[model samples]
Target: MNTKDMRDLDDAELADHIKTVRRDLFGLRFQHATGELENTAGLKTGKRDLARALTIAHERGIDTNK
Candidate 1:
């Protein structure tokens, strides 16, 4: 998703998206470690998406710890 999409989400939605993406990132890491992941670049993409969600959350003053 892009900045415009991120900005469209409310705080609660952003938080949920962050959580879901983080879970996907974890799964991707596990798959990569086990040599089951074909697309290794998924890790990088996951990290970037997570970071983007987090940056937007923080900048919007949304509590990420939730």
Candidate 2:
């Protein structure tokens, strides 16, 4: 998802998106460690996406730690 699409999400939805992205990033790391991941670049992309979401959440003053 792009920044524009992420900005369109409400607070709750954005939090959920952050969680999902984090989970996906974790899974990618696991796959890479197991040597089963073909597209290793996904790790980089996932990190950037997570960072974007977190940045947006921070800007909105949303506490995503919950």
Candidate 1: where are CA atoms >4 Å away?
A: none
User: Mind giving the per-residue lDDT tens digits that candidate 2 earns over 5-27?
Assistant: 99999999999999999999999
**Which candidate leads the pack in TM-score?**
2
**Local accuracy by lDDT, each model:** 0.92, 0.97
Q: lDDT winner among the candidates?
A: 2
TM-score of each model, paired residue for residue = 0.94, 0.96
Write down the worst ten-residue block by lDDT for model 2. Answer: 57-66
The clash number for model 1 is: 0
lDDT for model 1, please: 0.92
Clashes of each: 0, 0
Name the runs in model 2 displaced over 4 angstroms.
Answer: none
